[model samples]
Target: MLADRIPIADALHGKALELVHEHRAASVPLLERHLSIGPDMAEALLLRIARETTVVRRVQSGLYVYTHGPIGEELAALHGFAQEVLVALASNSVDVDQLRDAAGRYGFSIPHQAAGNATVAVPLCLAQVVNV
Candidate 1:
């Protein structure tokens, strides 16, 4: 029996795509470090993915931003919400109650039991963000 093997370039291309999706961003150094490939090959991989895939877009020199899919969408939404919260807070446009309501809409709520002991929840919230 004979088995088919994918060419090395194809394997690298697939792995590069996976790495970009997993990290939610991509760069030549990221590919080089994660794939253990030379700079030239890492750069070529990034160019190929940028040219061939729609999920990534070059935001600036040597930097690609993931702009689609579940993770990308969630991050984008969170960023927008954060900006809104910042602007509102800086202008004193919203009360604490209104801010809590807005945060609740984004799946965040102030724990009533953690009123003065907020330190205990900080690490847990950070872990959840990092895991996601």
Candidate 2:
């Protein structure tokens, strides 16, 4: 998982976010395996985390995909930027438009249809962190 290499938040919510971000799309079993969390724990985590994510309504049953949402208020700008970029690029390998779309998180849409909502500027700028 990509997130396994990236920094993770000490909180369960943060950890869960990283997991989904890494995998792009994830199932309950995937979360449980990576986090060593039980089904109940995964469910609880999903309930809260889903708000900041985009789940394919009719695709994978438990597939949870992350998007920078309100619940993500606790995450750092750098990390959140990574998550948003990953989610945008999940469906399509290299989509620069996805990064610019929505500004990166508004809410749920028909799966990949959502490219809205930005990471809500806090401090860290995506360009500043990336080197050309």
- Candidate 1 positional error at 52, Å: 0.8
Query: For model 2, what is the error of residue 108's alpha carbon versus the real structure, in angstroms, after optimal superposition?
Result: 16
Give the alpha carbon lDDT tens digit for every residue of 1-132 in model 2.
333233334497778767777786556777799999777666666655654444311125545544445434434334555776556556555454455443345331213435652333423454333210
CA lDDT, every prediction?
0.62, 0.52
Look at candidate 2 and tell me the lDDT of residue 124: 46
Q: How do the residues 1-132 of candidate 1 rate in per-residue lDDT, one tens digit apiece?
A: 010122247988999999988997778789889999877776677667766766776665657777667765565556555665667757867455555555556655457644442211223543243221
Angstrom error of the Cα, residue 64, model 2: value is 3.9
Error of 1 at 27 (Å): 1.0
In model 1, which regions exceed 4 Å deviation?
Answer: 1-8, 70-132
